[model samples]
Target: MAHKRDKTPRLGVGGELWITADGRNLGSHARMGLLRAVVEQGSITQAAKAFGISYKAAWDAVDTMNRVAGEPLVERRPGGRGGGSTRLTERGQRLLERYAQVEAVHERFVEMLAREAFDLEQDFSLLKVLNVRTTARNQFLGTVSALRAGAVNDEIELTLPGGMRLVAIVTRGSTEALGLHTRAPVVAMVQAGNVILATGIESMRFSARNQLPGTVLTLTPGSVNTEVLLEVDGGGRLVAVVTQASAEALALAPGLRVTALIKASDVLLAVTV
Candidate 1:
């Protein structure tokens, strides 16, 4: 097979990530690169240099990942004469495989944006790196502000730094289950449809939609669902999972005044609207 020119890179979407959709936060790009290089070179020092990180930093990342993953992704096997060489475990191999798969999709998505979202450079005026997930599952993150007890679920209100509020109905038992309370940082996870997108002067402005001016931060092409990130004022950000066709039509970008449409329905309203 003919090898093609190098292309595509995965970047972190600013703010909030659902682990279900994003794989575990075992480590980030540099860390993964370091791991792969270490496995290839069989030396932490060489791998660290290959990835442009210090030997100690690389070692730290590996240690932290091993700690968080609850499994060793790398193993050191004694070499005949050269002391020892490093190799990935079955667990490590699977981790690398999943990472590679996600990376391919990520690169492909960036390419899709460069083509489909041409105005992104002009449309997006702001962006920030909030978090990255190994999985792309539905999730939300914010500071908990209010909580109410109910017959069934506890209505918990999460207020984002930008003055946006999200109310979630968690079972009273489940609320107790999570031991949630005010001022607590929480992440909300739901289906893709749970998130909505809107532009200016649209009749479909979600009452739950948090309005802000932003540009198309990024667009990643998904086989079935495309992902779009919008950067809002004051470094605020949000992600919209929409069809590729829609993203092309709206031409969402960085300097554009796009309202992040979230349905109060998807998010509970703690106070009367």
Candidate 2:
């Protein structure tokens, strides 16, 4: 007789759950398990033994969590004849309960993701986008709407999602190496320092190739420089770092209309393979 083949999926999704506060890790499954053990054992020594950790290590973890949480999650009970007991505080119990609820929802999400991730190549591309990190303050995703080739250089025009246009100048060799073509998706990166902020230039001509008009959304002043964020026409934001003196001279303020001037040579283009 022929045997039936196993129908189980070869690919599965799994993840560990963690609780964090202010970007600092505060709790995890192993830590929560230690807390649960303390509740059941009523002794730090016993709990550490059951949790497969040293007693000192367990106490250190509890102390760190308590300090980060701004309150004690575990407390010591006065000893009688045997010894003092360890117990979870009210807040500790609530944390475990909430973690359980969130973990259930997370498990369901992972299940859905695994089911939909049959196309690994496409999903991996999206993961690549999420993992992209750069020092450039302004990164725009768009398509190459036009390209002009010259003897030694090429000018590339990118059309942003909201129909806004950006011009970049790159070497002809770089363009050919990137295989750039019209309608090809690309990322344009411009450092905040490279962007120039201006106001009242409606009829004036500028040497910069890209001029984006927008309203100043925020101004973060540092000791020597001010970082200005502008909300442009296509729901995109551009960040410009200028000298505090220059910012004061320009009278830049939130909600004030301004324009960002970027030279084509200052813009950098990138594409994902």
Candidate achieving the largest TM-score: 2
Q: Listing every candidate in turn, what is its Cα RMSD in Å to the true structure after a full C-alpha superposition? A: 14.0, 18.7
* lDDT tens digits by residue: candidate 2, 1-273: 998878754675677889998888998888888888988999888999998989999999999888888889899998889777888899988987788898887777677656544544331222233456788888888899999999999999999867999999999999989999999998889999999999899989999999999999899999999999999977688999999999999999999999999999999999877
Q: How many Å off is the CA of 107 in candidate 2?
A: 15
lDDT of each: 0.63, 0.87
lDDT of 1 at 257: 64
How much does candidate 1 score in TM-score?
0.41
- Location of the lowest summed lDDT over 10 successive residues in candidate 1: 125-134
Error of 2 at 256 (Å): 0.5
| Model 2 stretches with alpha carbons more than 4 Å out | 1-128
Clashes of 1: 26
* Top-lDDT candidate index: 2
Q: Residue 139 deviation, candidate 1, in Å?
A: 5.6
